[model samples]
Target chain A: MKRILLPLLIVVVPVAATVLWAWWPRTTPPERVSDLYRRYEHNPHLTVAYIEDFPVNDTLTVDVTTIRALDAAGWDTLAKDFRIEPLPDILQKKLNEGKDLVTTFLAPKVNPALSMDTTDLLKNNVVGISQLIHTVSVFSIETESQINAVVNYNLKL
Target chain B: MERKKLKGKELEALLSVAAAEPDGLPGDVAAQATATGMAGFDAWGRRRQRNDLRRRCLAAAVVSLLLCSFASVTAPEAARTSMVVNNGTPRAQVIEGVRQILEHKL
Candidate 1:
């Protein structure tokens, strides 16, 4: 009984399962797609703003002209707030070209302290500004000067 | 099969004969008949046992098939996806053409 029964079960079980899986009606649900959105980030020198598309989060529908105008307005506010306009000509050129964008690091320039620690500042924003403390500290920006501004404008295009 | 039993005068005659010869062929004939009958019965018993074993094996195989199906079945998972869209802006030429069309109407 044991000899015949063991071999019969081994062969039959897999064959029966494969047949059942093939005949089983598919009850798979429809696929749901998430919304797409836009975001931009500033470079180390604060000259060029790199923009790219990513999945999830808030969706933004913006034209190139609209982006250019918004960037110029942001540059003007940046000049007034930080009291230092090192890359004005370069940023203005990029903004005028209809292709590029501009952003600031040491940005959202909250307090006017001459020297401040960059341990946990500028972490929560549209851009990943947490990495800019080292990059923006170069050139003549030894200490982030006192600049009072809520420059984080959520310009909905 | 039927056998005539010795009774009355027949039984007396057979008893007398058996008395004449104490060791006779009659006893040996009876013992041989019993042995043949037992051999036939034994053969039949062995055949029935084989049939019973075959039935048990078939029943076990059927039960194993049912259990295999139970083990194979499982709950299905849901399908989902994430998508990225470029939605590129209008080309410079296309925008210029649209602008030209609007300007002519103005």
Candidate 2:
């Protein structure tokens, strides 16, 4: 019995340690995001990486049905029927309630040929009223002052 | 009769082919001829089993190679994340769902 128990302990100890190592709560804390961003600044393919502490089961939903293609025909249709009022207002309301919702839209580059206006509409629509922060094309657009730089810099794509 | 175990894709392929050629004869044949084809059917079935095994082994080797290469490239940064919290459904299911989504997108 003593010999059997000694061998069992030897096998079990390493197995338990490995299990703990694999499942350990190994996550980067929120504060280190800035550090991470600086580290990957030169990385073009690195794209975007930011953590959101959203409610456990809820999805960060983005309804792209209203997003019109940046063609002349599409623009005409959007100018006639483009509505950004409801989404921003709804997002503002959600933000005021202390819900965690941060969405960043990124493309290969910030140009007039990229979809930036839609994100602007989202930012102008909700930031003051809600805690939601909308960063578009690497430029932060939560403030009224920062809004113009993003709007001007963003190509109409 | 030794029953052979088949992986998911192989089983589907076999089921589809079997459904297509339920009767081994090219056209409608006499019952006697159909009965005589049982030996041929067994031979064809064995050939298919061997082919399926070969295909599965090749697929497995390719997948293993791809995974090993990917891991070698990414393994350094795998430990960089300290806390891996998933914001989805059941924990295990969410991991699988996220993996599928990443696989498709990547």
**Maximum-lDDT candidate:** 2
The residue pairs in collision within model 1 are: A112-A146
Predicted candidate 1 versus true structure: per-residue lDDT over B1-106, tens digit per residue = 3433433454445445445653562764334334444344344545655676567667766666766555454322111111111233233322232222212211
Q: Which sections of candidate 2 miss by over 4 Å?
A: A34-105, A108-157, B1-106
Q: For model 1, what is the error of residue B94's alpha carbon versus the real structure, in angstroms, after optimal superposition?
A: 41
User: What's the CA error at residue B15 for candidate 2, in Å?
Assistant: 71
**Per-residue lDDT tens digits of candidate 2, residues B36-92?**
444454566577767766666555556555544554444432232232221221333
Clashes of each: 1, 6
Question: How much of the true A–B contact set does each candidate keep?
Answer: 0.00, 0.09
lDDT of 1 by residue, A119-142 (tens): 645321221111111111111121
Q: What does the interface RMSD come to for each candidate?
A: 19.7, 13.7
Error of 2 at B105 (Å): 6.0
- Candidate 2, which CAPRI tier? incorrect
lDDT of each: 0.32, 0.36
**Error in Å for residue B40 of model 2:** 72
